[model samples]
Target: MFTRPASDEYIRYQNQYISIVPEGNIIELLERQQDDTVNYFSSLNEQQALYRYAAGKWSLKEVLGHIADTEAIMSYRLLRIARGDRTALPGFEQDDYIEPASFDTLSNEELLERYTSIRRSSLSLLRTLPITAPARRGIVNNHEMSVNALAYVIAGHELHHMNIIRERYNA
Candidate 1:
């Protein structure tokens, strides 16, 4: 089983997200989360899925898109680093991506379908990585990070957004 990442494995800013992940087999947690997230979002209707808790905040659809986008990015980083790639990966602006994504144009069902597909791809890639691959490190956003840390960040980031949807959006 892959172990949880230690503090030294990632930058401090990521700890806020990483800390939310419960101690366990991270791959299993990520796999279980796919269903949990899909079920939770699937429970919402069109109106609820479009809700924005406050002005300047993202609507539910946008948040879902953001989650999908982030997962794809992180998983790609994980793949590269695990494969012994040493190149520095560039950072992306989430707002820039979200605005152009036109997530609102897509139905909630469609958004969920896309998210599920991306997550399954990620799971497939992660499952194929060797046990030692988790320890592989690479530069991302100018900071060094391990494949394991990125995995935790992927899971914890979703948890963060889910908490926001529950507390702020009341969904």
Candidate 2:
């Protein structure tokens, strides 16, 4: 079984992401997330996909794209750390990524396709790592964190966004 990362594995503020992850094998959790997200978002109509709860909030399509984007970033970070790279990765600004990507222009199918493909690549990467990979650490946005912690953070970040998509977007 893949071990769950300890509290010391990540930053304090990151609990908002990691704390919600249910106990399980991290790889299985990721696969379940991939299936659940593809199934849930696939049912939305274009109207629902474009819905934004407030004028300034992201539309559901953007939310979905953001999830994919974050997963890709986290997965890259995990890959690097798991492979023993000590590179200090830069942090991304969420707002800086949105409008520039033009996620609002894509078909729901296109958005979900991007998500599915990225997630598949992530799973392939995760499956190859040595068991010792989880303990590997690297600097991200200036803070050191473990590969295991980043894996959970990726899943928790999606859960956080999915909650908003459910409650506020009402889809």
Candidate 3:
């Protein structure tokens, strides 16, 4: 199993996400999060899901969509790096993706189902990777990081947003 990534393995700013991830098996932590996040968001009604705490901020539904989109992106990065691809990858602007998605237009059940499928796919990919995959490195958006670091980023990013949903949106 992949261990916690060292600080140098990822971008400096991404450390915020990594920092909140408690010590444990990475796969287990991700599995737990996959279940917990789905359940948490599923509990919200339309009004609660539609909540946006401030002007220009994302609604809770948008935030959930962002989380899934980010995971899909990060997981693709992980796949390339783990498979020994050395091609330099590019970064995506979250805002650009969010608006077109129109997450608020979709039902909560639809959003939750999509998130569940993506998380399951992520876990399946993680389980199938070779042992050395974690140490493999690649350039992503002009920065180099390890596949393992991407895994942590995925987990940590979810936590970061969920914490915000709880504290900021209060949904």
Leading candidate by lDDT = 3
lDDT (CA) per prediction: 0.90, 0.88, 0.92
Candidate 3 per-residue lDDT, tens place, 16-122, comes to 99999989988999999988898898889987899899999999999999999999999999999999999999988999999899999999998998888888999
Best model number under TM-score: 3
Error of 2 at 106 (Å): 0.6
TM-score of each: 0.96, 0.96, 0.97
What's model 1's overall lDDT?
A: 0.90
Quick one: RMSD of model 3?
A: 0.9
Q: Each prediction's Cα RMSD?
A: 1.0, 1.1, 0.9
lDDT of 2: 0.88
lDDT of 1 by residue, 1-171 (tens): 356788888888889899999988887898899999999889889888888989989999999999999999999998999999999999888899988899988999999999999999988988998878888899999999999899999999999998988899866
TM-score of 3: 0.97
Ranking by TM-score: 3, 1, 2
TM-score of 1: 0.96
Which model, 1 or 3, shows the larger TM-score? 3
